[model samples]
Target: MDELFQQADRLSSSHIRDRIVEQLYKQSNQLIKAGVTFSKAQHNERTEKLDAIFTSPIFGFPIMLVMLGTVFYLTIAGANIPSSMLADFFGWVEGYLTVSFNNIGAPDWLHGVLVLGLYRGTSWVISVMLPPMAIFFPVFALLENYGYLPRVAFNMDRLFKTVGAHGKQSLTMAMGFGCNAAAVMSSRIIESPRERMLAILTNNFVPCNGRWGTLIILSSLFMASGFTGGMKSIVTTSVIVGIVIVGIMTTFLVSWLLSKTALKGVPTHYTLELPPYRKPKFFDTVVRSSLNKSLSVLYRAIKVAAPAGILTWVLANIQIGDTSILLYIVNFLDPLGQLIGLDGYILMAFLIGLPANEIVLPILLMGYLSTGSLMDVDGIEDLKQIFLDHGWTWITALNMMLFSLLHYPCGTTLINIYKETKSMKWTFWSFMIPTAIAFLVTFAVAQAALLFGWG
Candidate 1:
């Protein structure tokens, strides 16, 4: 024991420490074979398994993708009904608010801002955000409970190694599903400063729930056009899955770029241990992952989204120089927006939606509806009509999906990057890098469409 301690002290490197631990663990196992206690032997065996899987390159990455896809699928499919119900309830409330305000002779501006602008926006937030999160978080918690998440880290260890990041980034990326800010904070698990910064910088590429909502909505409405009946769901699901794949590819690309440039370093190894799959505690999984995580996210969305709704309503309703502030801003951005295969309103929505990516779709709907004053449309088909009014061709939808796939991190993610790196420079880069990629991709696509006479 003294020699093992001395060996550990003499070797300051992680590699040396790992080797010493390995040898000590092996000797402990041998002692157990010589009639040591069951508990002690089991403990040593567990440590060895942990060391081998975490440090091993094989069987790490495939597991990571599978876990990620499963979490996303659960969130995507589960959120559907709750979102619809929430929207219906909120729309019902909106009708009552209108009647009540009109009955009391409330000022038009105040009614518009509070009820139309503020309340409607909040409704969108609750309806859209609540259900999926309620579904996603608990399922996520279940995964965490069964200790599947650690195995993900174990499986992803090699990819992290090649990219000069800690294998534990798998866990942080998982956290990003809940919220990018939380994921960024989780980067503290990485001991290497450069790798930590790299993880922080590139973390935004993983779409949070807010971004996921936008992707899902866009895919379902626009990209699912080729299919009918039951096939539509499958096609839409495929599109959503494809968007996720793009996000992941983008993450790896950005991470690779960062490692070769500012945050360059050789990747460090990790010792991840896959815990035996435990039968998930059913109710606890629901309470912790599904209910708690969903509600927490919904609570945050309502807080941020309510104010944005009010602001958007105000901008839409207030007339300035024969156009509302919303129109004025959208008009100004139109040409640039058009170049990227989106309208000015879409561009403006993305700008305002910086605070929370989840709000981007709601904001875009607000903008589009404001143009036509279509304040009453509720169904997805109604949304399809609204897009048709705005000249949303299949090409337009494709570009929008592409833009959503590649856009900058939300306001929460930006703050997360700043917090994790503690550097405004890195945060700025994190924002700019993705935005640049989005613009370039969209621009190129639009140009190609025009050149081929597809527009």
Candidate 2:
């Protein structure tokens, strides 16, 4: 048996292969220098210099972090006014819709289901979720078009591989910025089954578009409350970036632990190709991202939120004795939710939001107002008032943001996990693992806050 594969062992030595490739590249560079003309040092003179700074030992990760902070800042700060405007327009439209339904002699139940339930939920999703995604995807597309995403993979590769994940998992995590379900599918790029599974399970650690609105609003409303103007936005962005760093660090920890336990395996080598950076056509990139990514995601969110609205309306309106069914459920979950620094309504909203996270805020608002239908706040001030009315402190806001980062993936992502793995056991683990982690992390924070009188 040893003799049969003696030559194969030599072929499979990663060190030898790496050295050979390095020598080949070195020779290729020498030949290019000898043969190529000076006039053709080329337009990528800037590219070489940028790569040196961007990928340097001294500056590489710092640049990456700066870029990340910048993106979050833009997404958080830039989305504000447009989101408020969209909310106003949607509110106006909802009022007109209610009047139209009344003038047409529509039944109260019909109005509740369509106008109050479906329309409100869908509009809230559009107004809140759309602007961030609209701003985020275009800027991300700009970075992607300029060929910087691969550098992200490159910069994070050693860390991931050291933690027993594939380098390309970074790319899938980036894709998770768009959609976790899509990121699950994108994990196909990882050839090793164990590493691929690791990537799939941890993809939710990088908050998706569905979770962004909640984090941004909560951070701005609570974390930056004392500040005003540009200072407020800066503080909000910093908090958001801090939350993102937590998510990323959690990903690394989970990947490491799983690699040392159930998913234990040797890391597989992935050859990363760095492409020449090109100036992206900003307008075209924006148009394509807005139309292709943002609008498409918005449409899917509406489809899910619409049905959620109907269910929530039925639950909130239908009574079991003196209390609505939704309240009863919230009451049942209150003890558990309180243990984690969130209330019953927040828990119920999260459970309902399993289908689509965009609906969580609306359901929470409905639960707060007992409105028999989902609601969208008029502005940040209105939202702040609502949260205050519900006893939301900074601890609550912080815990909620952490849970949003760590909780179970949406239904679509779960189904994709099942389909991708073809193993119900693994899919169940994926759901349970993140859910358990979220509860445990929040419980610790809540307890620590209480012990120190910080709550």
Candidate 3:
């Protein structure tokens, strides 16, 4: 092998590897013809036609988008009932916790911190994070098992290569929709260090499961108005799909910019095998995905939620003159937030919800309620009323969705980026790059809305 490699290096001008492969194929054919008695070739016509459709440049992207949108629609529709059920269960548990604390003669502050703060925070995390993960991951894993995921990467390879990134980045971006932290960790599949870094920096542009939960809620609340039944569902799903498409476009644009500037490099060639389509092992895929991806994400989120819950509780309760510190911070942030088409409470929610994106909606509702406890609202109508009371318009909701899609990665994702890169500089860029894009995009939209008198 060493001698062959040396000879190939010496004949580099002739592209020796191609010559070697050609010669090897020629010899193998000769040997087969001489030794074999008979041979028959078999082909699957269905797979061939499917591949032609899936890999065609004109239709490939649209097909991929449709498939992705279908998956998201199913996950969103499927997770709702379970999410509400879990919330009710947790809420019941909270009632028991409060009574138990009272019976034990726990101090008011301790009870407030333990029950309203830590316990409620963990409950919200579980209720919001689990259902989506459970639904989304297994569906995604089915795609992987069915061998469609690589075709997705194949379809996207040209675009990523044009942006001077590894084609495998497409797979990582897909993983990001399940969880950005998991996606960041999955960047290892890319072989080149520079391209891998590009993948890491750009992964956050794909909204993760946590952000999806918030986006779905806002979409249902704002976009479903004036439409009935099926039309309503269609509009909501389309709006969410539109936001996801924007995130994907942003990923490509930023990847191009970084390739041309900061992470300058030419695209490296790579081979991608289009695996044979096979029957997916449904039970095994679901069990493995739930244990490996869903549960792991839930665990990481719970760890951060507990401490963040306590801190948010403190901020909401600690008095500053007549108002709590939380109110003071919101007031301070309101001006900039408004400039970006979001209010102080929304901005504060994003900041406080940094620990876990699953908690942002809960925290925002808590802020609106002016209660120290994070509580669930009655339904979509009630939530819409609360937003209307706070002067939330279509512009506000749209920009909020945009910002959520483009903003900084959650705490777990940031930590994973740091771990993967082992450099504070890249991790910092990973944070600032998306955040800068988010601010600029929202600011422009807000300005445009104001100019059109849509604000």
Q: Output the number of the TM-score-best candidate.
A: 2
> Which numbered prediction scores highest in lDDT against the true structure?
2
**For residues 1-455, what per-residue lDDT tens digits would candidate 3 score against the true structure?**
99988877788532554477669868977897788644332334466677999888889989988998788778778887898899889888888998999999999999878888889878878987799889889999999999899999989887898778889999999988888888999999999998999999999988888887788878887877878666666777888888988988898898899899988988776778788788899999999998998998888778877887787888898997899999999999999999999999999989998877877876777677666677656566877998999999988999999999999998888999999999999889888999999999999999999999994
Q: Summarize candidate 2's per-residue lDDT along 41-85 as a digit string, tens digits.
A: 666677788888888878999888889888888988888888888
Model 1, 1-455: lDDT tens digits are 99999977887576675678789878976886798566555565665575465435664455555565666666666667777887888788778989999999998887877877778777777777777777777777887786667766766665676666777777787787678877888889888888887778777777777776777777778787767765666666677767777777777778888888877778876566556655689897797765567777777777887788777877887788788999889889999999988999899888888888777777788888853233767788898888899898878888887887788888877876776677788888888998999999899999999999884
Regions of candidate 2 where Cα sits further than 4 Å from its true position? 1-24, 36-39, 374-376
Full-model lDDT, candidate 1: 0.76
User: How does model 3 score by TM-score?
Assistant: 0.89
Candidate 3 residue pairs in clash (backbone atoms < 3 Å): none
Candidate 3 ranges beyond 4 A from true positions = 1-46
Better of 1 and 3 by TM-score: 3
By TM-score rank, best first, the candidates go 2, 3, 1
Evaluation by TM-score, superior candidate among 1 and 2: 2
**Which residue pairs collide in model 1, if any?**
54-272, 60-155, 137-289, 138-289, 138-290, 210-358
Q: How far is candidate 2 from the true structure (C-alpha RMSD, Å)?
A: 3.9
lDDT of each: 0.76, 0.89, 0.85
